[model samples]
Target: MMAFFEKLERKFGRYAIRNLMMYLTALYAVGFVISLVNIQIYYEYMSLDVAKILSGQVWRLITWIMYVPEQNVLFAAIMLVLYYSLGTNLERVWGSFRFNVYMFMGYIFLIIGAFILYAVYGEAASVFLLTPDSLNMSIFLAFALTYPDMTFYLYFVLPIKAKYLAFVYLLIEVYSFIIGGVITKVSIGLSLLNFVIFYLMTRNWNRISPKNVVRQVKFKKAVKMRPAGEPIHRCAVCGRTEKDDDTLEFRYCSKCKGNLEYCSDHLYTHTHVE
Candidate 1:
């Protein structure tokens, strides 16, 4: 377990956002503007009218981000700000390009999942799961798990880690699913499913996301093979070769056989071949 964490830190240490998370915050700002206009057409549009998406009115998929539960501007603004703050951190760490890719994939997955549900269970499941109010909490849950240790001032009184709170949220959702019946369970199921899909795609498993690390290792190997103008043997203690222009001569260490090299200063002391 310790070795596993060490390797992960080495690879993904730079992925923690520095300032790019701000752009995610700004996306929420735009979300706020759309919310103010109260233009919630896509709730019905995406379900029954995806032809609009194919017809080049492509904003339906993206516009759904702006949908809010109530028409309360204050609540919308507050939630947007919070979403932005956490999301931008992820964006900065992952790069805007990768961040957009991840979010877009999540959206696409949700839409596809909705379409399947509609075909199987009809439009009711689509309306229940595809709406902005329904899906936003799933995005929040994703952000919470990514930064599990982050502290938030809950209701401006209780200081709690976001992940712990998110876990509690999940528990309630689970309880609702069990007691609240099929419609409610399906709602929670889709949200959890979306997160699982995204995590598995981005995870370090060799079968899932192998291309990124493979390219890096290939690049390092190419760097190691270049000669430094010296046809020389390698040192065993520290990996270096004697440069051709250097005054000290180097030869394979007799004591170490074909395994080591030594210069003149240590030639006698080190024991080497002529």
Candidate 2:
């Protein structure tokens, strides 16, 4: 899966959008303004209605993303800011191309799920699949997975880890799916499929295992127990020993006159010794 993404990056990375989340947040803000003026207009034109979409109102396919989660104006503002932060961080961690793919795949899944629901129940599917709540939830889930230890203030009072919040959200979604109508159940499942597939593809089992933790501890102990002595190598130009900076890499200057050792920083820039 990583190989496939690498191939995609090589071929199409140049076209990937930078700060894609900022644009999405802008759309939500626009939707909010429209809603304040006349929510009926937004529902009639912007919301994802399969019947309308099938009957030549095809714009809903893309415009449906503007369906911001229902909340008060103050809360909505805070949530959008949080979402923008999450999106930018994910893009940085996963790279622009991969982040684009993750978001686009979620949109594609929602579209397919909408059509599938439409097939199952002719027009009623439109009523239940109105909002992009599932997509928003998936984004939160992704952020939690990526930065499990990050803390956030819940209601500007209590501090809670993002992973714990995500877990609570997951439980709520599970309950909703069990009790919700067919369209609701299907929407939840399809929206989460992107995160599920992504997690499976990118997770490293070894990093999370007990054996790896033990091995790391033993390695650290061995390093600490080593005899104290002068570093075997030192930079000729900088005169900084490896003991001072473990990250410093020493290399013999190939172009220099004798065997002159130079640190990585000065390896190419230093003049040749006579």
TM-score of each: 0.54, 0.75
- What's model 1's TM-score? 0.54
Compared with the true structure, what per-residue lDDT tens digits does model 2 show for residues 1-274?
Answer: 5456556777998898889998999999988878777878877898778889989999998888887656479978988988999998788766777688788888888888888778888877767664677877799899887667778899889999889999999999999989998767877887788889977765544444676566557646765876689465678877997788775556554335554667655653466687
The best candidate by TM-score is: 2
- What lDDT would candidate 1 get against the real structure? 0.56
| Local error of candidate 2 at residue 150 (angstroms) | 0.7
Tens digits of per-residue lDDT for model 1, 1-274: 3235435545764664445446544655665565566445435443223444555757666665544555577776688777666666555434444455456555666666556666676535534445444355766687675666667898879999878989998888788878975546655676677777756655535322355355446545754785656444555544445554343345343235443555433432343343
Report how far residue 49 has shifted in candidate 2, in Å: 1.8
| Model 1 residue 81 distance off true place after TM-score fit, in angstroms | 0.7
